[model samples]
Target: MAYQTTLGWSLISSGIVTLILKVLPYDSLWWGLLLLVLGIAILYLRIS
Candidate 1:
């Protein structure tokens, strides 16, 4: 129910923000990996 609620887009936006952080000025692989994993985790939760 939480995901279906009005605030669901806010959750997705957070994930998008995470992805953007990884996108701009690539310097550390670890940072990009962290964002990638987090984005995947968010998508996983969204589907389940």
Candidate 2:
């Protein structure tokens, strides 16, 4: 129950949040890469 509500739901929510951030006006491509990496880290932490 905790995994379903916390990890699963948080992953989905973070994905949407990142998607919105991507659509925002950002001049730096580096930020996008950082965000992608951070997303991966989140998934890794959750699964581990």
Candidate 3:
């Protein structure tokens, strides 16, 4: 239950961040990659 909630929030937050990054004029490839890595790390930590 808690894990599901965490995963849901993480996805939501990552989506929002991705959208915001898309809107910015600056290059976001690195930022997006960083966020992806961070999100994966978070999920890995939660699972273990």
Q: Which candidate is the best by lDDT?
A: 3
Model 1 worst lDDT run, 10 consecutive residues: 21-30
Candidate 1 ranges beyond 4 A from true positions: 1-27
- Model 1, position 22, has a per-residue lDDT of 69
After superposition, the stretches of candidate 2 with alpha carbons farther than 4 Å from their true spots are 1-26
lDDT of each: 0.77, 0.79, 0.87
| Clash count for each candidate, listed in order shown | 0, 0, 0
Better model by TM-score: candidate 2 vs candidate 3: 3
lDDT at position 12, candidate 2: 91
Model 2, TM vs. native: 0.45
TM-score of each: 0.45, 0.45, 0.57
Per-residue lDDT of 1-48 in model 1, one digit per residue for the tens? 875874888788768877877677766567778867987999899999
For residues 5-48, write the lDDT of model 3, one tens digit per residue. Answer: 98999799878997999887768987888878987899899999
Q: How far is candidate 3 from the true structure (C-alpha RMSD, Å)?
A: 3.3
Decreasing lDDT order of the candidates: 3, 2, 1
Tens digits of per-residue lDDT, candidate 2, 18-44, equal 787777777436767777799899989
